[model samples]
Target: MNENEKIREEILNTVNGLSDEQLNANPEKGRWSIIQVLDHLYLMERAITKSIADKLKSDERVQAVDKPIELTVNRDVKVEAPSYVVPSDSFQTLDEVKDKLAESRSAFVQLVHNADENDLEQKSFPHPLFKDLSLKQWIPFVGFHEKRHLLQIEELKSKL
Candidate 1:
């Protein structure tokens, strides 16, 4: 979680000077804008947090092997964003997205801090590409996922 916080701070610093218009500008026809990327991160975090909470409260226990989830940061292999996590095209301010991000992160942190490590390791959830991932792995996976988009955000900023 410390590492995740560092990455999150880096992301915020990366966009510190930009205007809202720059954040919302699309780099190309098919690509997402910077704000959209941030929004996607927020949505993904919230969804993962909820899923973890659900699994923790359930009696189901499916042990899963740890995956190379760090591979998530590799941009060479393109994975489509799940529809639920896809960001809207509407313009959004950084503060708006940041608030959403904060709320999601707060919930995620609270859940993680309260959850038992053994419970997290015993439960599993399916990832589209990674198959069934343990809840234990899902925690850091969020950070890796954010790191992936941080690179994308940098690219989008360059184009803007």
Candidate 2:
């Protein structure tokens, strides 16, 4: 397997065995439950697929995304997605989240291998806390972000 595929397999393996409670529990108020996190992550993967496959262009006016565990907690923003921020949602069940994640993760791993180098470098996307970032940076961010959240989930599980 390729490097991207290897990384994907490792990450997906981690996600596969999550218990229902572990997947559905929220770490904090106004925060995403584990299920929500998976859906949101799937949402992000779709956006990335668009970027890489379509050779997308960003309008300067488009908002940015923030960091992992990244909450804007900002009262000022009213946009559908905070400019430069990841969206959080409340998914009803772990099964629902996992279903979507399975699709998104497969597509994402494929995109990483198929991505055009130029598109990866030239495009910029909004981050919630951090400002704009390139596709190259964003790809790795997905892995790092997932791993971080999994760590959070594991910690929460241990406490239970």
Candidate 3:
């Protein structure tokens, strides 16, 4: 969790000082802007946090081996974003996106802090690319997911 928060702070800092126009400008046709990437991160975090909470509450339990989820940071492999986690096309400011990210992170942090470590270790959920990942792994998976997008954000900024 400590590492997760640190990565999140780094992500926020990466966008610091950019004007709203720059943040929201599309680097190229069909490509996401910086704010879009941030919005996607917020949406993904909220969905994952909700899924974790639901999985924790349910009786369904599945055991899975630990996956090399750290590979999530690799940009070589391209994975399409799931429709549910996709960001909206609406323009957004840095502060707006930051608030959304904060809200989602708050829910995620609360869920993990209150959850039983044993339960987190025992249960599992399916990731699009990673297949079934342990609930415990999903915690840091959020950070890795963001780290992946952070690179994208940097790329978008470079183009702008």
Candidate 4:
């Protein structure tokens, strides 16, 4: 399996048996619940996949920087979610979150399969925190983003 697929599998495995209470309970007043984190991850994945697909179809291409991956993968720096990608209380159950994540991940995998290797490196999309990133970088960014939240989920679980 590819790195992206491995990461996706790991995330699904990590949250496989979480109850609704566990998923929705926030560890602290200002902190996000596991469900909220998953929702944000789904939103970000869907948005990033769409952005990369759009960029691939467009005639425009931008020079991608190498630093975006570094910045995104760095766990020490906490970056706030953009307004558009922020999670809401819309998800009432863990099943609902799982459905959305499955749909988004399927679309993401399809986009990756359909894209050319050259185009993956050439096409660029705007990231809220890191600015423009190539399709290649964006795929892995999804994984890293999930991994980051996995740590949060673990912390939340501990508090429960």
Q: TM-score for each prediction? A: 0.98, 0.59, 0.98, 0.90
Which predicted model would earn the best lDDT?
1
lDDT of 4 by residue, 1-160 (tens): 1766776677777777888887888779988888898888889989988888888898887869755464555668888788988888654697888899999989988888889888888878777777787878888888877777777777787887
Runs in model 1 deviating more than 4 A are none
Candidate 4 displacement at residue 130 in angstroms: 2.7
Across 1-160, the per-residue lDDT of candidate 3 in tens digits comes to 9989998999999999999999999989998889989999989999999899999999888988999999999999999999998888898999999999999999999999999988899899999988999999999999999999989988988899
- Candidate 1 lDDT over 1-160, as tens digits, reads 8878888888989998999999999888899999999999999999999999999999999999999999999999999999999999999999999999899999999999999999998999999999999999999999999999999999888888
Model 2 Cα lDDT, one tens digit per residue, 1-160: 1443454455456656767776677667665555655566577667766655554544333333434423322324332543323645444565676577678778777776776676667666655555676666677766655555555445554543
Output the lDDT of residue 126, model 1.
96
- The collision pairs in model 4 are none
Q: After superposition, how far is residue 92 of candidate 3 from its true place, in Å?
A: 0.8
Q: What is the lDDT of residue 25 in candidate 2?
A: 71
Q: lDDT for model 4, please.
A: 0.80
Give lDDT per model, in order. Answer: 0.94, 0.58, 0.93, 0.80
Write down the TM-score for model 4.
0.90
Q: Model 3 off-target regions past 4 Å? A: none
